[model samples]
Target: MNCLQSVGHSRFSALPWPKRVDAHHRRTAVFNGFVGTGSLRVAAMKTSSNSRSSLYEDETEEQASSLDAKMTDLSDREEKSEIYSSNMTQAMGAVLTYRHELGMNYNFIRPDLIVGSCLQTPADVDKLRSVGVKTIFCLQQNPDLEYFRVDINAIQQYSKELNGIHHYRAEIRDFDAFDLRMRLPAVVSKLSKIVDINGGVTYIHCTAGLGRAPAVALTYMYWVLGYQLDDAHKLLQSKRPCFPKLDAIRSATADILVGQWKARVTFKWDGDDCSSVDISGLDIGWGQSIPLKFDEEQGAWLLERELPEGRYEYKYIVDGEWVYNSNELVTSPNMDGHVNNYIEVFNEDVNIEARQRRKKFMDGDAELTTDERKMIRQFLDSYKDDADLDEEEAEVRASATSDAIASGTIGVPDKA
Candidate 1:
């Protein structure tokens, strides 16, 4: 079967004699082709079936009652032993056998990466190491480990001392999508580093290997391996059964446009008694217009809204006629193959006042001398012309230019 159906069938009965009734039935089943492995100890009931039958037929009512009480007492003791048992060997045996029967704990997503459930016991580390796993990356929080009875310290110690295997842990709360997204970067970065350094298989796991662990793996494929988000999900699901949260992975990678910092942009059209003045461009989709209200105080038509950090090309429609501000600081070719007024919205953190001040200067929202505006316009023009440069080289040049501008330098020439 189905992996979940198998797990539901065996979760309680996986261990030998966890229940008294199951224990009693095992004696008859053992003779009927029921094979037990060396790892698991299949215990049988102390009283034989023949004796049980005889006791029911020949024994007094009081004796039968006494036997029933004795069996109940035996069951209570067995249950206690099962709960209080800390024997690593027995736990490993049960975990291994359970994993074998269920057939869905772990699988190789990539040749170098195996993703699945947590290591249930210390010996699991050794078993994994035998399969050429040089690193074990766990994504369980402390409560999950305790609830699953996973002796993390023992596993770590055994991995280091017995096999020199590297074990790393990220405290990603199980089933919490927000926490998974927040912690994905550090976890993926660390996993990538370990895989590069170790050069062997890395086992990544959360509690059930379904949600958090799979999300991380999928994001790694998308962010690091350069797989498209959908393609990465398809490849991962093909390798192993999982329910990865795509939203969580997308959020971590900044693929969605929501939640980013937006700079307040004000579009101004200086005109008198226009029937309708509208601003239209790529930022708000072509042909769609946001109407600009006449500002009685500033004596102009103005539209203001927050726009995400990016370059946008927009033009004014003054009474149904397309118009461009020839004096605008920035201009770029539009989708309709016409030159249009543009502005650069820079990325900013949570400092609202600082962002507003920068926006005023860069977007021409503040008063500036004619010469100062011309200088600013020239830098933007040059920057747009060099847009096709490699990203790393552009970043270095941009940073150097920013510093030079702050130090009152006009421009710096390239070395060669």
Candidate 2:
């Protein structure tokens, strides 16, 4: 069963069919059993005794011609519906393809995923890798050149094109079956991890990258791209010139992904009286701290990043001192045994930003960027700090700190 043996199951007939004519017996097999959901290569294995086996054993010349014509008509209509139909292929411009080899018509469905046909030549693989593709989603088994051409060796042949481009295969037989809906969560989750961690390009393809790949791509769009179901469908259609048939994507997958999107939260960070913000748990940069720009609207240094359901730890640096959240009774430790403040993100659809917007606290804040505000705050803080020192020393220290703050040499400090 794993090796693409024709099982003659009812599901096989539901797959994108290819016409196979038995020249000797004048019989035809339109649909066949699929290889497991490993890759897009539907290594079809046709059953020997078709239940609809016709008695064309003694077919005359006219009957054979008629059968051939019927097959041709069916194939032509199938082509018209394909994403790679000649008109659609030409309409997609250079961004898509339906060329001689494996007739792939790949186009970007999202910032993360590109859907298309199989890689026909080494150049095709090179083109993908050149643009920072880290993963390839193959839809077929070995040598479906009529649709696409690929094998482990064939894909591995161009390994140097990337930092070892990884290959993922998910054999698609029944796009709308309960099996597909059940598998959708795990598949979408893995794809989400790849896009989230790397933020790099991924090439997803079935032999044609049309029927099966688009279905999976649509799922990715809904779950990971943060798009609504209708939006995802429209975007996929605009790029590839077709969306998966209504039957290809089940309602359950749509509900799960759409629900996930609404459950996610936007984590916003605002730094006051600081030139930059650094986090110990995330990649701020290439081992460098990220500088935050003062946002006049927010009246603080702001950075907004999306966060999913998880526990994260972070600390803020203001005026060269770390501010730990007092909410945590006991901080968690990293492998190095150091402690940091933590927060748990849940599916509470609360808008922290909107509430904060109504209350603007410019009272004694020292992070103001305007020159007039800076001087006024500096004078007030100076008088407060100057009370403790001798007259001459207080005058000198006040001038030094004020000048340093004005010159951007040091971050301004607030009251003790």
Q: Which stretches of candidate 1 lie over 4 Å from their true place?
A: 1-12, 15-104, 255-416
Candidate 2 RMSD computed on C-alpha atoms after optimal superposition onto the true structure? 26.4
- Give a tens-digit lDDT track for model 2, residues 235-348: 888887644633324333323322222234333345455566544332221112344456778766655555433334455555555455454433654333445565554455
Which residue window of length 10 is worst by lDDT in model 2? 1-10
Using Cα atoms with residue i matched to residue i, what is each candidate's TM-score against the true structure? 0.44, 0.36
What is the TM-score of candidate 2? 0.36
User: C-alpha displacement of 10 in model 1, angstroms?
Assistant: 12
Poorly placed runs, candidate 2 (over 4 Å): 1-103, 141-149, 174-179, 254-416
lDDT of 1 by residue, 18-107 (tens): 443632332322322434433123334466597776564343444434544545554543443233222211211112111322322788
In TM-score terms, which candidate is top? 1
- Residue pair clashes in candidate 1: none
